[model samples]
Target: MGCVLSGLKWPRTPSKDHVTPEPLLPTLGLTPQQQQLLIETWELLKQDIAKVGVIVFIRLFETHPECKDVFFLFHDVDDLKLSKELRAHGLRVLSVVEKSVARIENVTRLEKFLFELGRSHYRYKAPPRYYQYVGIEFLSAIRPILKEKWTPEVEEVWKVLFTYICAVMKAGYQEEENKHNEKTPTMKRLEKSQATAM
Candidate 1:
């Protein structure tokens, strides 16, 4: 099932790398059953959200060391579990997931929120490619808490949910990047030169 969904590639705009069009937001693609599963599973995960958050980031840093550099606060930290900063940051991320789950039924609102989040991430120098990693780590962290409740169907729904979130966020990041580039002096000069040449 994962392999089948794998073929549903992230939509990309022609202008830049993985920048999707803002107006045409992607669908959540989750059925009623899937949404219910997410809502139910989320209740169980929420009981240990704080612990799960720490575990998620630690596993992320372990699997992808480059991600650690993104968090300047965690740079000098020797132990992630003991780091207060890590705990706080992990909780903040879990909060975003909480918000997303709450807005699952409202696609437009969810997209707008995630889009703004992506724009913020762009400012933080976090790339869209890394967004998927969070989803991966999130699934890993929740598995133990969910235990028997975790099934292939539940996993598929979570994967679909993350895929949609990451896609919208990537679009938002690209839009912000485009705005920043347009404001650059080099871009202005290049545009002027091109106009004069024409």
Candidate 2:
């Protein structure tokens, strides 16, 4: 690891001509029971995906204040109150989530979609840990909607699902980073900074 900028540690920047690596993660499988829980609960929540999405962002930003920098769209809308743009963003995110959950049974397509998702998120410069926090906040946000149905089994299933999702996404991020590392520009920047610091 090296300082990305302003001494904020980041993985070393890569060269421009670097080749993209093969997928860094194996496919993750969910049990039929786990898939059922995620799909069923998600179907129940889709009716108010906006509300749940709003809650997810609110709770996520509340829990992780530093995460706001990653979103240029919502960068200025820092508070819990949902701005129109924030709401729209939330809607888009949840809509995607809804679609992804629907594809849970089709692991091949799901992983491919998630890899694309990871690349998009990398463009936002959002770290993988933020995804983890979002996963946690999702469960918390949905707990009320689920009411009595939010059982231990449900919680465990979601947690496992998020882990799998994040792993694949991180793999995508790492693949990009590897390509970046093969570039000269980033390497020059890193070397110059390290030299000055020394």
**lDDT, candidate 2, 61-121, per-residue tens:** 7777787877667767645464887788788877767767888999888888888787777
Which ranges in model 2 have alpha carbons more than 4 Å from their true place? 1-23, 78-80, 186-198
Across residues 127-176, which tens digit of lDDT does each residue of candidate 1 receive? 99999999999999888889899899988999999999899999899888
| Residue pairs in candidate 1 whose N, alpha carbon or C atoms collide under 3 angstroms | none
Q: Give the range where candidate 2 is weakest over 10 consecutive residues by summed lDDT.
A: 2-11
For candidate 1, the per-residue lDDT at 127 reads 90
- lDDT for residue 82 in candidate 1, whole number 0-100: 92
Measured by TM-score, the strongest candidate is 1
RMSDs, each prediction?
A: 8.3, 9.4
| Top candidate by lDDT | 1
Give lDDT: candidate 2, residue 151. Answer: 93
